[model samples]
Target: MDAATAWLVAAVSLLAAVVGPFAAGHALLTKREPQVATAWIAVCLIFPAGGALLYYLFGINRVYTRARKLVAEERLPPSLAPHPTSSSHGIGPEYAEQIRISDAVTGRPLEPGNRIQVLSNGEEAYPVMLEAIEGARETVMLSTYIFETNTSGRQFIDALSAAHRRGVDVRVLIDGVGEYYTWPRPSTLLRRAGVPVARFLPPRLIPPQLSINLRNHRKILVVDGQRAFTGGMNLGDSHLLQSQRSHRVADVHFLFDGPLAQQMEAVFAEDWAFTTGDERTPPKRATPHDSGALCRTITDGPNEDLDRLVMTLIGALSAAREEIWLVTPYFLPMRPLITSLEAAALRGVEVKILLPERNNLPFVHWATRHILGELLHWGVHLYYQPPPFAHTKLFVVDRRYAQVGSANMDPRSLRLNFELNAEIYNRPIAEQLALDCELIRARSRQLSSAELGERHPAERLRDALCWLASPYL
Candidate 1:
């Protein structure tokens, strides 16, 4: 062989040796999970060049770094800072422990005097929300994951445009990836209508920040800083069950008025600032109501706030004495959550989880089946609500405490995507949500160990494979 060809081969070998160990060392020092680190290390060493490329493309988490930097540099507007401690007036002695746990999990105080109304679907929620937007005299802020430019989406665009024309301070934030659901994107229409709109983490070639994960899955709408609407419902016609017909998605949204609205607005302000780097002064705080419930906002994401929601959930579960009711579309919970569920059931706390019979994502549904037998073995009750695919997410404990928001039980919602939830202390609202869970349960079929075992061998294998990939799903 020529000396030139021999030199090229030696240079390539030296480069691979350097790259493989460098990538493997980064993974070993940074990865939180031992299994994940070992797998990446093995891959990097086994294939050398190809493994290094793959690790560069997918193994490193840029989302966490960017998010942490942004959070560290920018702080929430001063007007929205939490009080010294949670309010103890309306809270009872029984819930003192839960309050303390939440206080530590999230450094926010329990805002009292919040009036909450559970709206069943978009059909019930949209009209009132639009009415509030129409009457807005000061500011209007909205952030949603999906903003389809369909019939329902057009109405919102029109309303927001009109509000902007009236000299109201209006801002709209739509998820970067979720804006592509339809042609002539909602961002395009909003901008054309002279509304100030921004997309959160849009991927492009110029600057090149491309990630399919790390989505902003939060849904929030605050009108005039006096009332807000939030929950699992997205802004699209699909949520309007009666009108959507074949493509209907059943979900629940909450209409809230009082100090909680300001807390919701605070969260919006934080996101808006993060997206645009413009932290305007927040609007005036709403007058505290005479009588209402205590509420606190819990924000979770892949950065500084990682694992907060799950920790808060575990805290609530540990504090439960009587019953726990949970409903969500996805069910790929992390190991810690699984252990918590088992412990809750073993403690004789009536633990019930409601999930959709047919999920929009079939892989998640199949993966969920693989863990059913374990939960059933531990006395946890599971139910599958009949179709149209319920998109509601809620957690009610002891008929006196509840958590409502856009976060689901899956890894995507818990650890990757940005999420928002509210811890509520009110018997009436919690009892109402528990009643709704009961209604869904009545119409649903109980999932038993026998049913899970009846699956064919091939089906079981498919589910096992899916379960193995649950962390990514």
Candidate 2:
């Protein structure tokens, strides 16, 4: 009622009104996703100060600025540049448009003469990785999202330490958040053993440079620049066999030999440079193998290359004429990806998606089930694989193109976390992957429209609530 109190209230109201629209305008300008932008704008308008602070802390595009600086300052060899005539590679005229799109997005060419060998789980991949590390003549580069100090992790640590002791240039990078599995992280163990190790974006609260959300989820290993391994397997006991454990995790990993390996190495080198601030000379290009496998490496994250992987997937789906088979542990596809799949299905393309029966992350499982009804309604067959929780990330299109790597279908892998995948244009590899998919499908239970319709009301409500959080899941 007093004039002074009225003046104070009026000033505060005026300030909030001015600040709210400014923040909302900033969100509208920066956010690419219409839904995200609208949500942020509404929040900024309704909550003002609190919304502005939250946006300042979490909504800004910090990664893109840092990534641009890193890329600009990092000196890379000319050999890492895209090949000029790679467009003419034997991807067929039908896939030419997709290839061009991929090339423009990734700045990498379709490399030919690469040989790929699929490795199933840690049982198959670990021995080969250890052997390659032991035989390393010059350098060994290893990076993974999770590097737990468990049985398999210890073995890897030993191999890497031994390699370092033998004077091989060994560098290891592990995700900071993932390294907290044990008291002394695997990176610490490697560092104690004199192996050079760096943690990607360790937790920091003061300067606030690191992020727990934007993780490095890529799993890559290159030995001597000649052989490389990558896929869904991380360094942990969970991935390896333990007789006492009844349920285990299954995944698909791959070994690459030839020119494609160099591209993989280039990715590792770039990450290493970004983390350690060390200038790296490009690794020698591996000789092309006799095999005619044409492959290209695709890396995506929330940085400058945001949505590249999802765009690549959409392009591949649009190009598919016969079939699309995808296997992932988690499934929370973006709107564009879902639309692409629906369009492909409408065009008579067989769209089959296989997911784990039970996921380690319960929230992700619930969120994934939320989208099944729409997919099933659109003629996109959904299959739930039986347990031992398959964590394989794979995609095969038209029995002529295949992709395998560390990315899941969720927002975390596709948009938030750093991820890598290899696209193969070889039919033999694609056929083998297709056969593997079939074997998995034989054990999976397909979800029909009736099955989804029969879900309990409470379960449906839970799924809807979980789906609401899919952007963060």
Instruction: For each of the candidates, give the backbone clash count.
Output: 0, 0
Instruction: Give one digit per residue, the lDDT tens place, for model 1 in 333-372.
Output: 8888888888999999999999999999999999999998
lDDT of each: 0.87, 0.84
Q: lDDT at 413 for candidate 1?
A: 92
Q: Distance from true position, residue 364, model 2, in Å? A: 1.7
Error of 2 at 140 (Å): 0.4
* lDDT tens per residue, model 2, 164-265: 999999999898888886656787788899999998888878877646677889999998887889999987778765445665789989998888888888
Q: Candidate 2 has what TM-score?
A: 0.91
- Give me the candidate number with maximum TM-score: 1
Q: How far is candidate 2 from the true structure (C-alpha RMSD, Å)?
A: 3.8
